[model samples]
Target: MFGIYIHIPFCRKACHYCDFHFSTSLNYMDEMVDAICKEIALKADRVSGTAGSIYFGGGTPSILPATALQKIFQTLEKHFDIATGAEITLEANPDDLNAAALKTMRALPVNRFSIGVQSFFEEDLRWMNRAHHAGEAIDSIRRSQDAGFENLSIDLIYGYPLLSDEKWESNLATAISLQVPHLSSYSLTVEPRTALAAAIEKRKEPAPTDAQSAEQFRMLMARLQSARFEHYEISNFALPGQYAVHNTNYWRGVPYLGIGPSAHGFDGHTRYMNMASNATYMQALLRGQLAEERELLTDHDRYNEYVMTSLRTMWGLDPELVISRFGRSYHDYLHTALGKLGSNDWLISGDGKIKLTTEGKLYADHIASELFKVDEE
Candidate 1:
């Protein structure tokens, strides 16, 4: 199944830890939206199959005026063969969520809402430099539910320097208490060049420790599992069949088209990303050219990508698929790597598939790296 992702690269304020391409300025919103709609029209033929999912992700998708979102959705419907029952998700921040805005959203074709409620504590919110307060975070969900939007997901960040173990537990409890259907929890990592990194360097903010992050991750797993949430993915939990279909399709290596500044698209073989700069993107689109760069994937690259993504999911890596796709050498290499990790209880093999155990998940990246095939000089 194919998917479409629209990136809205504008936020009200920059979160200290965010390294994503977004501007706090809304001056270019109109022009950017028009350019994106045009880009969508231009690239519609590129994704001619029925779309299973349409995702509106960004700096803050909810920050856009409802008319802007409506126009884009209309354009998509006009050009693409979107499925009858597709999962259309909008990533929103709590501050932008109110009764009036949610009522407008409910009238649209959007079926899912992924709220960016990173924390439920005021101290943690302040630490993250988020725009919303603790109360707004809780109210946003309640407001959505009040407006008859139930297919909801909330994002949570654990392991922040200010988020104590008790506070982390409280955050999860708040989500569970709200009866949020899906939860996407992430451990805070200070990416290079972000404000968080600079702050840590200057001793303004405490740096995130690996031990704290790992403990919080463990806590996340335990709490969610006890609440009957399915650990469908490494960072995602759902109730029953409520997985984020857009993200799942992406991890499964399905073809998708991404539009807007800094958007990335994959069409099975080649991957392309739009220019990250808003001015450059707008200029090029106005000139009727998509400002993007493309790279063709080599066999080794594809295999390694498969290993990295599949190994992290609950559905593990299928050995037979590997053998059939990448030949005996790669398969044998994987088998050897699996054997090395066997003693550590990092992997469990049965049937034709091999997946990571909970303990193995802690070192998932390291394991994938060990299994990687570097290019020969």
Candidate 2:
């Protein structure tokens, strides 16, 4: 029931707001892919059982040449016991998708395709410096469906300074019209040191407003709910039985192995992150070293991690699991914190499960922080 995530750190173009570790250059793609395969082989013993899901995420996984992708998949199959019906997902950009490319993808065992279609408006695409056009976004999904990819997901972004509320509505309507089974929507945040932030400081671009973003989020929830899509997580919507098993496992604290530069891996108690520099990662791997940093979790850190992730999902936190894994004292601390929030109507406890109402979801992080176990001074 473990999952595998492969990070392809190369993209054709850099989006202004993206803070994810990725390079616009493809010069090191071959070496990087080789290094990823080596890393996978080196870390094979970390997870004990067969893989239930394998996700190819990235700078843009679709940018990989089909031959290269096939090689990576073949290498993984060689080293791991991938389940026969495993959910294999590839995060792709619209420009890289074509009839022939999709046909090749279908031939492989990949069953899910998560297409990056941030907007269906050319102006927004230009503002974001995305590599594809608005037309390509629609065409890509249409072609994917025609190519027999029923389990499809599309990524959408709202709250951009340039995205009007009307445009945001149009974007969701477009996805619904395409009949996409799953969606991963996000609010645009200006990360420090990214081009988007720089542009705002330089007066070259307008900054995103909190009020606008909040309104758009409210609109998103209402529209998606009306369409009968389940708001299973803070930023995800899916049709029945279409939730992303890979991401769901991560939220539930399931162990997973992540490969490639800047990738992260987590067992229940420990976490590892690969070096962000491509050259350093490859060099270290060549020397038979895992170029990664590791952190040993403290009891407080584990409790905080569970609260942060579980609160964002529909499943909420389980008191019984916490008491068994953490301790009676930790469990008692949770009850105390729950009592405070429950009185505030931010949390509802029933059937041994604690869940947040719609009002509570707005301050989910704040609530989780209040429940966090602070270390003794």
Candidate 3:
């Protein structure tokens, strides 16, 4: 089934580690809402079938007003067929989930909350320049549960100097205790020109170490697995039946439509992304134009994308699918390149699927790129 993504590009504060396209300014919030609604109408025909999931992600989607969210939801209702049991997720921050806010949200169509609980510690929150405190992080989860949001996910971060092994352990323990259905964790990566990168250059913060990140990841796997959380995707852990439908569809290369500045869409053959500028996106949409760029995928592009995504998931990559879908040439290339991953010790073969061992996941990106297809001459 197809999915829909709406990017909200405004946040109350700019997190130090974020390089996502967002603005701290709310100067154009109303205009942006209008433009996004216009865009949903604009691209309705390009998408096919009922949406199984609709994800409102962002620069803090929870920061938007209840009225604004409702307006967007109303627009969606008028445009497409949304599945009755569709998974609707809103990426919310801790500070935004007070009682009144949660009350208003309950009335809205959103059924899931993906809380941005980067770390449930005071120092980590302050270091990352997050707007929430440790207490709010803890309280927010309980409060949301009281508000009846069971389809929940909280994001945690590892691999930063500020996050010690003990602190990382505390974070996982907190996540398990909360009993949130889903968890998405990632190692901190310093993006160029971001505050974290600048801080590292100026010796304000210690650079993230590969050793620290790897250790933390291993800790995460053991903790989550013992906690009975399925390591579904490399960075994602969930209780059984709680896998994120939207993202699972995305990983499986299902077609989706994205509307808003800095949003991306895939329609099987072509992938498109909107211009990142809020002003530019609004201006173009006001003029009845689609503000996006497109790339038509070649077989090489498609195969490489498949290998990269599939390998990162628990399902792994299928050699037979490569032979049938991408032809025998790609299948042969895959077997030949399996040597680059070193011994088959880290790779296990069962049911014709090449899945990575937990040890192999630390090098997943490198491994996937090693198996990438070069366009034939």
Q: Considering every candidate listed, which one attains the maximal TM-score?
A: 3
The TM-scores, one per candidate, come to 0.98, 0.97, 0.98
Writing each residue's lDDT as its tens digit, candidate 3 over 1-377 gives 79999999999998998999899999989999999999999999988789999999999999999999999999999999999989999999999999999999999999999999999999999999999999999899999999998889999999999888999999999999999989999999999989999989999888999999999999999999999999999999999989999999988899999899999999998999999999899999999999999999999999999999999999999999898888998999998999766775567888879998998899899889999988889
Q: Model 2 clash pairs?
A: none
RMSD of each: 1.1, 1.2, 0.9
- lDDT (Cα, 0-100) at 190 in candidate 1: 88
Candidate 1 regions exceeding 4 Å error are none
Better of 2 and 3 by lDDT: 3
The true-versus-predicted C-alpha distance at residue 81 of model 1, in Å, is 0.1
Candidate 2 residue runs with Cα over 4 Å from true position: none
Residue 282 lDDT, candidate 1, scale 0-100? 94
> How many clashes in each structure?
0, 0, 0
Rank ordering of all candidates by lDDT, starting from the highest: 3, 1, 2
User: Considering TM-score, where higher is better, how would the candidates rank from best to worst?
Assistant: 3, 1, 2
Which candidate tops lDDT?
Answer: 3
For model 2, residues 1-377, the per-residue Cα lDDT tens digits are 89999889999998999999999989988888888888988998898889999999988999998888888988998899999899999999998889989989877888999999999999999989999999999999999989998899999999988888998999889899999999999999999989999999999988898788888988888898888899889899998889999999989989999899999999888899999889999999888889999999999999899989998988889988898889899999998987776567677777778888777777788999989999867
